[model samples]
Target: MNAPARLRVAAGQATSVPRDVAANVATACSLVTTAADQGARVVVLPELFLTGYAAEEWRHDDSLALDASTGSGGPDERLRPLADLARERGVTVVASAAVRRALDASTLSAVVLTPDGEVRAPYDKQHLCGLEEQGFFTAGDHGATIVVDGWELGLGICYDGSFPEHAASAAAAGATAYLTPAAFFTGSDHRRDLYYAARAIDNGIYVVFAGLTGTCGASSFSGGSAVYDPEGRAVARTGADDPAVVVADLDIAEVRRVQDEVNTVARDRRDSLGHRERLEVGRAG
Candidate 1:
């Protein structure tokens, strides 16, 4: 079999229309088109790009109800056209949407759309931040790793990035790249920037992070969408306040080189030690 194609990924960072599902979907489609024109093989949009991140307002709005797709049906019918666009352009599109999980009546979630327009398995944000999303959304029980064009891709939402375990778990699951769709605020931008880079270093994988800009509800987002190489170096980054598409030609070969140099995975072999520690703790108790 021929080797998988090396993907040129684009992280589309822009201001979203809060509570405006139609406009948001249109904007995302436009961005995807633009990215395809620019020769991007894979495009990643911000978390909850379709409805913005106004959790409480979105949860109550009835009009927004139409945008929510059942997990089994793929993307909403309105957004179905995007899937055709992806196929036409031959680009794997990863866009976020506010969705209703059919399994539980009370649960609303965020999900990713594949280029074929299929909803890849959903990864609801496992950790909700502050009061905004706490009661409004239900945390997802599992994480997903998708392979697109031979690239092992891991998915996570905004608050999920703050925790090391989330990225670590993805890395452990053989993810070569971690993709985060975030709506990060101003003061927290620097911390997030550093944390993403650190996660790359720790996991020895590339990180493609996109964040929303402008104001959503009472919160203002910092638009520092970036791509980090396996060595935890920023290969390409946008300004914290700029609305633009950040593109990077990632070298899959470099991933292996860095992994060999750092050897974090090979050297950190304490698997048996963990069991020993647990046993010791049990005895002590």
Candidate 2:
């Protein structure tokens, strides 16, 4: 029997010390160490992880934003340490930070630090939540996808995963795995949990969610970090429980099994429904 493209992924769910990018990056580095120790090739973190998802505090701190130029950090340098850590640990790190698009524009973006320590193109969140105001952030025009070990991993931030159409666009473009880095709040758990799995089954792709867990004073997030299979099954999950690292081995060929049996994306559509008409269907990751 032929084996699938088995990628070991880790969703590192942990709390952050509000407004401290350096400290949060430290926490993420530690978690990445743990996940890497468990043999995870890819580690995806929560949304706005470097800033701890401090929301208004993050929005107000102009100094906290990352620039489009270099992947350095802090007044001295903080983010590069995480990339260095990823290189040392031999893991691909997907972590979010606020990006300064222009002098007047900024957006929440996921930066991939490869195992070789190269900074891939940043995946900016296209669908902004209420907090991402007009002047603060420039909404991204296109979705982002990265090819790793031959797997096309689609990128999405917290609120972006909630919409069916957003994920649909990525799937349309041949994304084998939708990796959502998010900070979902308390009441949003049930809906997000249900929707993440549905996105996997409905699209016949792997869905991996790495979300912020725990509370910061009055604010809190749904701590459920999870990974779902193409069959819409929970390969790994951590509910609103604790800061933990959940890892799963995704069988990429299942995309073919599910599609060959059901064939939703290829057979069920009418006119792409306002979406562009380029079919980039994946060959099982």
Top model by TM-score, which number?
A: 2
* Deviation in Å, model 1, residue 127 alpha carbon: 1.7
Q: Highest lDDT, which number?
A: 2
Give one digit per residue, the lDDT tens place, for model 1 in 186-233.
788778788888878877888898888877777778888889988888
What local lDDT score does residue 30 receive in model 1, on the 0 to 100 scale? 82
Question: lDDT of all predictions, in order shown?
Answer: 0.73, 0.78
Model 1 ranges off by over 4 Å? 1-5, 60-70, 102-110, 263-269, 272-285
Candidate 2 lDDT by residue in tens digits, 72-114 = 4332266677878888988889888776656666777887888
- Pairs that collide in candidate 2 are 73-77, 73-78
Spell out the clash pairs found in candidate 1: none
Clashes of 1: 0
Judged by lDDT against the true structure, how good is candidate 2?
0.78
Worst 10 residues of 2 by lDDT: 67-76
